[model samples]
Target: MKFEKESCSVKELVDDLYLAHQLLVPTHLRFSKEAEGDLFIYTDKKRLSQVITNFLTNACKFTNSGYIKLGFKHLRGTDEAAIFVEDSGIGLSEEEQEKVFSRFFKQDEFSQGAGLGLSICQGIVQNLGGRIALSSKLGKGSRFSVVLPVYKGG
Candidate 1:
């Protein structure tokens, strides 16, 4: 896949996504986002959106009744931007976390997917010169983040 990397406003993307996925959020779960100001990133906007979409989708599926949050965090002097999806859901064990990004690995055998969503997300982030990270604990929750270089455009 070809990526048309460009400068995109992180805030705007989050706003659009929040609106677009409103219907997908389960009635028993709470959904929210945290995007402050006009954070910018130099990357393929569509690809980034795809990664976040997968994160949110998985979070909702595993979480029976909890909160899912999408947030963008940029440290004042850091060179990276972190766009993340966090959830209070059925988290992963150390073993599952190690293989979560592998091509066809799924923690839940009955889950309705080919288990490619996270693998694809990893590929997309790598192609965009970023890294995808996950933090989770069994029966607690999880946070998936895509960290990329910040856009320094004037």
Candidate 2:
């Protein structure tokens, strides 16, 4: 798929996603944002938004309670910005984390949806010339992060 890449504000995208998914947070869960200022990146907004939405949706679904935080910031001296979603909910084991991005992979068989979200997200990030990362521990929580090149000048 061809992505319509462009220079866009990371803060704006985070704000939009936060607003779009705020009401969807479970009553037992609290949502927050860690993005402070307007950081810019050169990428496809719609595709990146999809990746983030998937992160938020999974965070809400797996998290029984606690907080889900969305964050974005520049990696100092790296010319890249990291966008991440962290949840204090059910996380993955070492084996699970290794295969979480595989197509049709699901931690819970009973969970809804076809297990294609993360795989698609990885593809999207890669197409945008970025890399996606994940950190988690069983019974703790998980964090999904995507780092993209920051938008310099035109």
Candidate 3:
């Protein structure tokens, strides 16, 4: 996969999310938004989308009842925007959180994919001069937040 950075519009990014939302409906998926202001980021759109998609897919796999929420907010005094994907599913432990972003690390047997999603996300966010973090409580849920800088000239 090419790792070059690219400028992407908020509308375009949301469009991809909308498509994912469609696929999520049959699984009883739902999204709650509290996004204000324009959402934009300076990063590879494909890679970022992959991150969000992976998060959402994981949420669906773990959450059998409550909904998954995607939120967007801007950081003041900086060109950074925060995107959060939260789910009311089986959460991870503190130890698990420590290695969630490590390559090929999987929390348990319930997880799917090659276990490289979070690792890829960390690399992508770092490549864009950003950071990714997570918070969770076992049996409660988990939230993955990606902080990315907005493209100032695009």
Best-fitting candidate, measured by lDDT? 2
Off by over 4 Å in 2: none
Model 1, 31-73: lDDT tens per residue?
9998866688989999899989999999999998789998888
- TM-scores of the candidates are 0.95, 0.96, 0.84
Q: Candidate 3 — worst ten consecutive residues by lDDT sum?
A: 25-34
What's the true lDDT of residue 130 in model 2?
A: 94
Q: What ranges in model 1 sit over 4 Å off?
A: none
| Clashes per candidate (backbone, < 3 Å) | 0, 0, 0
Candidate 1 accuracy as lDDT: 0.90
Report the error of model 1 at residue 55, Å: 0.6
Clashing pairs in 1: none
Please provide, for model 3 over 1-154, each residue's C-alpha lDDT reduced to its tens digit, 9 standing for 90 to 100.
Answer: 6766777776557556856676664456566654676766667777777777777778777787787887767778978887778988889998898888989998775656788878887887787688987889989999888888777873
Query: Sorted by TM-score, highest first, which candidate order results?
Result: 2, 1, 3
Cα RMSD to the true fold for all candidates = 1.2, 1.0, 2.2
lDDT value, candidate 2, whole model: 0.91
Candidate with the larger TM-score of 1 and 2: 2
lDDT of every predicted structure (CA atoms): 0.90, 0.91, 0.77
